[model samples]
Target: MEKRWLPLYGNNLEAHSTIENRSLTDLLNDTTAKYSDNTAITFYGKTWTYKELQKFSEALAASLNGDQFKKGDRLAIMLPNCPHYLFSLFGTFRAGGVVVQVNPMYVARELEYILNDSEATHIVILSDLYPLFKSVRDKVPTKKAIVVALKPGAEIELEANDCLFESYLKQATAPAPAITIEAENDLAVLQYTGGTTGVSKGVMLTHLNLVSNTEQTYDFMFSGEVSPPPNARIVNVLPLFHIFSLTCCNFVTIRHGGNQILIPRFDMPEVLETIKKEKPFQLGGVPTMYVGFNQVGKYKEFGLDLVESYVSGGSSLPVEALEAFERGTDRKLCEGYGLSEAAPVTHFNPSFQERKAGSVGIPLPNTDAKVVVETDAGWEEVAVGEVGEMIIKGPQVMKGYWRKPEETERTLRDGWLFTGDLAKMDEQGYFYIVDRKKDMILASGYNVYPREIEEVLYQHEGVQEVIVLGIPDPYRGETVKAYITPKPNSTLTSQEIIEFSRKQLAAYKVPKAIEFREELPKSAVGKLLKRKLRDEELAKVEAEQSS
Candidate 1:
């Protein structure tokens, strides 16, 4: 079999090369040694140099070690992007512990499941979220919790055993103790992603997996049309909890000795102002953020042109966004593709090569990707340009789902990670994502599983049958809409269900629209056909677009 993309490789990128085995700590270590004085992270009014970042990480590590945080202990981080997030990450790695990524917006019900399932004994959370954690504290196994208050003089009442971040860091000043880390076998992070059934599955990523992916990302990107000098200031507003940002933005930037400006949340005016003031060379964001910029429609005034490189990930890039970027800024918006299973990144449209607007360019070095169709004979590789399931084999692939053997087997087959993403590879080896095989909805770059919402709606006595699906929205790439069959003589309003879901689930997971239906499309076996509902929605979207 010929590697069609081999021809497109530049002099800098090798089609195949030996991936160096290392740990995530080296990303900071190597850079800190060379660029200690370079600014590493900037959040709000505070800034940290590489040396300060390492010092804080070591301090946090010492605090954890002093508090009996042993190797392999799961430490859940439930805070948004801030300097504290970086400290927690490196601190955990330095302590030879595993970092579990948890969304900060999780409601009490959703929060309890992740903490208890991961068996995380320690958690570093924002002070604003203390009440939420306090509500579920008794339900989880967490023995220690550190609360960080970003606001000045903000008071958060804590348990007697719990402590404030400032207090915790006071004791983290000693030298980091020696601990052996087996990068290949030892788990470094547990990235929780939604399973097919809407259950949360913790993706077990080894240090080697993250390290290899970081290196691959660097070579594939820097060895291209993008050749930023070391310590270049970078704009990073993507939430650090997400795999896309964690690996691509945080890991890659720290390793590259770059200064990253962190924004806690997206506010268009604030973002534009930051870009104007900071004048960073590059920015990484999702389609929603780019669309936000597109909505502003003021490229030159806000200094959007100051940034040299703009990359999009986390979800599909609306071609409108790409075109809007080009029209407004005369700069290309590179869209990449990846999933949490493959340490989150497998393909990126290169800047050095013939950049395709719709295609997620070829696989990274040493990564083998194939689009295959499952038939009675077995899984057969589909011809180029044919849509099929994208499967990948690479060093960057994760070990397995944490503690879920059956789910592990289902996703990983023989050394290949089965990505349930519908895609087709061009003859030139560029891959294009057509749709998702699973009923996962991407709303504003967040994965909203239909089964999870249906399961929640089922608990409501007013709902007899329910189906959730994604619909086209101009703002959100896809907005969730629920088709619900009410119980006889029951009245349920969209507002009522939305309010209920807002209390139980995260804001993004809640359905934005609801429709009362007499019946939903079903198969001959009377099984509710989600695919049919999706098809109908797509048809409706198509009709709307045409009109």
Candidate 2:
């Protein structure tokens, strides 16, 4: 009988002593062994069974002549969510290559930089994105072979120079290699993150880092419970390039043996249509997704009748958005906090327990979390319920940032990953996020978390999207400003939005001014690029203040 990991007294219980220890690659083998006939991936009416996925993955590995690349050689994969994406990902791992995950939406400049920086010798991209790569492929030093995936939802146009993915599968006949992979501390993924600070850098996650985090999230959700029906379906819309979706939707779903319905894009109507058809048991989304879904007042159109859980991450879930969703679907939205550096997920609200509306829940099982104060005397753990830098030390913490030893040392100290996020833990162990250290808005000697202001703006019916930022204010040092994108066809004025927000937000927390745009700029992974918006807003504010 397979040993089951159970929660002890609502806390995480250690099972390292009971189970057969294995690496991530080994875990994949076990999944294939148990769920060979089960459906592993479903997209656009196409389903790949676990057996078929395993076979194709091994075949692709064999065909790659993977021995050519060293054990930790990086293979950059730039493609959207598709069957080939999965095959290439697994195949690269099976071939003993580190998967350098790249967002498909990246422009030439971004793509070229990552390619050159990582020294990625081979790249697998989508057909449509190939043209963009061709623009800068010559400038990148490490790119040698460019393998393009056939564009789905269109007629096959196999160029003479381009090798069809199907042809490679035909050439691969050998089984996957059986190797004792150095998985514990070896780099498995290089996920890139960018912000106002600097250029994008790869977040190095090890096999144990990813596996531990996935298992932690899975355990928190109580996946594979006894009383509840075991077979469940999860709606996955966030891009897999993002750590949040990659860990929760893709990796954890595999462990839970849950069916994942992948939607390449988050189109409101299409998502609702799919939901009505599939009646998924769980839905995972960011704040933007939840807000958009709530705006689709035709909530009845979505078959939310069967949904048992809804998880939110990437950003804070607004109270109004959660309430609206709950009112319409009767499903509570559980919000959590994590970053790309920590294998994406560290803490989450217990799926079966009482969920606090504004809090981001407690730490994961087996993970130690503490708020530490930083001073000249060095770092010291702060008392409970005190706001400070949140630090985590566990198997889930990444090995370090790739190639940047200085950064790795700075981030990882004394077995603890010093996350730059600000938070406080309550008496009950529930953690509440204060804000991002870099995102703190200094207004007249006061520090404000933009999420607090944004939450108030989200309560307005006409507000479609809102991003609060700090603008240079000579008078007060800094002033709270808002950039809003209202609902389509809605004639909400900036003054009206400001007035409505003023009613709810504190005087200092309220926006001194507001600007309305058609849409807010977002990262390729669907995260709101507040830094970009802030830079633009700061320039505009500086110009106005100078005049």
Candidate 3:
């Protein structure tokens, strides 16, 4: 079969390629050795050189090894996008321990599930989040809690097994202990999902999986453009715990020996100020951040033209948001698609080529993707422009779900990782995500993808945010329903929204019911939580019927 994306490859990209087999720590070591004095990371007003980052990570790694943390031991990291997060991430890898990424915004219950599931022995967290951990510490198997102060001179009341992050690093001045790591087989990081579909499971990404994905992203982003190694400064506003941010911002920058400006969280003012002051050449963000930046109406004043490349991931970029962002900032916002199972990136819009609006561009080099329809026999590849599950085969694919062989077998079969995302490919090989397989609505025996309706709804002037879901209908098996958050102070009614959607979508796909909302629930990284809206609507219906 001919790959349609070959002609769309960047000038420097090949139709197929191979990546080096190396551990994440090896990439850090190589960069630190080559760019010792170069700035590696910038947070707020402070900076850490490659040498400094390497030294600090090594120090922490020594401490972990000294504390009898062996290879394959899970070390949970629950800090935000701080310098401490990097230290802990690399330190765990250097100590031959698997790093389990924990969302800093998780409550005690969510935190307990991840810790207990991964069986993490140690955790590095921020002082502000100490209470959440404290509430669930006894329920998990965590042996030590290393706390980092978010503010300077902030004191933390440590428990018996707790230690300050700085103190832990200070205990090991010697070089990191040597440990052999099998890059292909050894687990490097266990990334947890948001559990939108079901219970969150650990995504076990091996060292090779992460390293390959980083290289794949680097090749696509830097191909035929400005090289890295002190020339590129990538502004990272996404949370470090998310795989999209982890691969693109943290590892990709480290791979190129480029500087990363880290923001603790997405504060529009802080992000704009940092971009204006720092003058970063590249920025990675989600669609919501792009929408927020477009709404700021201050890009021209701040001279945001310095940003040459803007990459969007985590969720499908609404066409309205993309156009507004490009028109507002005079920069192209390339939309990409990835999931936690594929080391987070399988497809990205080529930076140097014609970026198709509403498409997630082509698969990365050496990655093969095909849309397949499930058949009684097994699975059959679908034709172009036909919707099906997007299955990908690449080195970046995860080994499997952590410790869940049955689930792993179900997801990974025949060397293809079955992405639960429903997508369609055009003749040019660009893929447009239709929706999640589980999120597809069956109404009147016709399939309706919520994303199609949501995209049309987003184009409405009064619609600020909208989530389309399926509700149980008495006539049709399911009916389309839209929950819309209107623009502030805009008296947008359900009739206006339904009328607007009717013009763009098919009669069957048009929302049967439109409900106005003040705000929509979003994930920590700002992706709209359609599952929450679905659950709430279902519960309300059940209550109404019962009453």
Give the top-scoring candidate (lDDT).
Answer: 1
Clashing pairs in 2: none
List CA RMSD, all candidates. Answer: 1.3, 11.1, 11.0
Off-target runs (Cα >4 Å) in candidate 2 are: 1-21, 142-162, 173-176, 223-231, 439-547
Worst 10 residues of 1 by lDDT: 15-24
How well does each candidate superpose onto the true structure, as a TM-score?
Answer: 0.98, 0.77, 0.81
**Candidate 2, 1-547: lDDT as tens digits:** 0111123223433433122345566666787787777777878777878778777777767766533555777888887667777787777777777888887766565678789888886677777776776777779755444455555455445433445566665665565466556667678789886433434668888887788888777767663231113446677887777788888888877776666778877777788888888788778887767777766676666677457777888766666667877888776678887888889777777656667777887677667788888889999877777899999877778877777888889889999998888888776777788766767565543446677677768889898998888876543446788899988889998788778865654455668888888889999998898889877866887788699
lDDT of 3: 0.84
**Which pairs in model 1 have colliding backbones?**
none
Candidate 1 residue-wise lDDT, 211-252, digit = tens: 989888877887876767768878788888899999988888
Candidates by TM-score, descending order: 1, 3, 2
Model 1 lDDT, full chain set: 0.88
- Largest TM-score belongs to which candidate? 1
- Those runs of model 3 whose alpha carbons end farther than 4 Å from true positions after fitting are 194-197, 229-231, 440-547
Every candidate's lDDT: 0.88, 0.72, 0.84
Candidate 3 positional error at 545, Å: 30
